[model samples]
Target: ILILFFVMMAQMVVLTLPRAAACLNRAQQVLEIEPSIVDGERTLDDGAREPQDEADAVAVFDHMSFRFDDADEDTLCDLSFACRRGQTTAIVGSTGSGKSTVAKLLLRFHDATKGSIRLNGVDLRELTQDEIRGRIAYVPQKAWLFSGTVASNLRFGNEGATEGDMLHALEVAQSTFVLDQPQGLDTPVAQGGTNFSGGQRQRLAIARALMKHADLYIFDDSFSALDFKTDAALRHALQGETRDAAVLIIAQRISTILHADQIVVLKDGEVVGLGTHGELMETCEVYRAIAESQMKGGE
Candidate 1:
């Protein structure tokens, strides 16, 4: 009877081995999968660390184009633009026009299939991901926050940030609601900032990004949640904070980017217009139509 019992136990163990092997193979395959973009080996020297010319372009897109591996057509086509320090560059377009892709390309989230993107005259492909992202502060369309105190979330941007720094950033972001909380900066935040309203979460996220010292500031539709008054005031205040850095605003509302130094109008992944509000109205029919449509809608 004991020998028969041991044989049954051994059989059960052997039966599980095939399933375990299959699970191990699946895990191994996931582990072996290569990252989409490889890190570059080049390092920046001390001289290359700082921009020699203040008037020089901070980012240059040289006829860049991109297409997903499964897509037949390019998402962005021969896009060329330059963002300079101390100036605002805005990209606006209808849905599926590839407005946000420009920001992703700059962040090196995806590599261009054709042409090149350069930062401070250096090709983006030649720099490591960290090196490229270190000089940029980006706020994505969706604002997110971890479960922690407001101060803790702000510190995620700059570990050494003082209370004063946090206050200034909050003030500039038009996030004074934090001050009304019982504990102010110590106010507890729920995961993903679910405790706060959409607009409040956006303001907090903006403040966090502001805490970082960056040469380029990218706001990807970050102002969508704010009221018109708040949006205008925040932009007004941002001028002071970003006076020394390049500002890139990706927006759908024409009012959000009407005063941008350069407005890039994209239609079907191509630049249909490239100029200021006044200039585009006169030159680019696509831009004029968009502006007119928005005005009619009272936006």
Candidate 2:
């Protein structure tokens, strides 16, 4: 028995030492690396100027470029575009084409390496990160939900949101199934929303963002998990709910972005086309090829 115990102890030490060393190394790297994007001292509440008009709520990227640390080349180069208020702008691209990078820049996740990005005519770097994000509602590619009641999750957007507000958001997100639950809003959600399907979790996430009543909405491929019927219904409902706010959609599907006011096609981290879908089909080979591929796959 003593020999067996000793062998097991030795095996445990051998297995855990390398893992502990790797974990410590990673933690040390995280501690040593400082974030490039820092918050400005000024805040919107402290007499910061508000946007003057619908156009002012616009997000403008002027010759924007970014390169990740330790990377050899820029991830985005000379990108310029405008996302106007009361309209939808869709960024479509192949993988690694930097569609999500544009969204990250808008959110100030990383500062542009060259040129500038402005929101409501104010440079993003001039405003505190909180101040910049306060006016935007973002739904990430992965829908995350904490272990809590549905109402608790919804309240993350607006702490003062009422049950009626939550219900309205759910309706707009096309997630009326929540109302059928015995506990309704009080139903407990497992960690990471393990209790719900991918589409259900996405709908809940969208509803949470809707509760914010923000000036801008960024949907980072938020509808990818839903079926066609649900995606269409949600988009139609969103048109009514978000009629006044600027919307930016990073999408992989052509059908998802066909109705957008403008479509920006990206390839190899550069913009190859900028126009409406019909115009792109006629003018941009990249856009035409992507549309053709999707159409062929559908058939």
Winning candidate number (lDDT): 1
lDDT of 1 by residue, 1-299 (tens): 99999999999999999999999999999999999998887655534553455246889888999999999999999999999989999999999899999999999999999999988778888889998888899999999999999999999899999999999999999998999989999999999999999999999999999999888999999999999999999999999999998999999888999899999999999999999989999899888888888797423
The whole-model lDDT of each prediction reads 0.92, 0.91
* Overall local distance difference test of candidate 1: 0.92
TM-score of each: 0.91, 0.87
Specify the poorest-scoring 10-residue window by lDDT in model 2.
48-57
User: Which segments of model 2 are wrong by more than 4 Å?
Assistant: 1-33, 45-54, 296-299
Which lDDT value does model 1 have at 202?
93
**Error of model 2, residue 265, in angstroms:** 0.6
Clash list (residue pairs), candidate 2: none
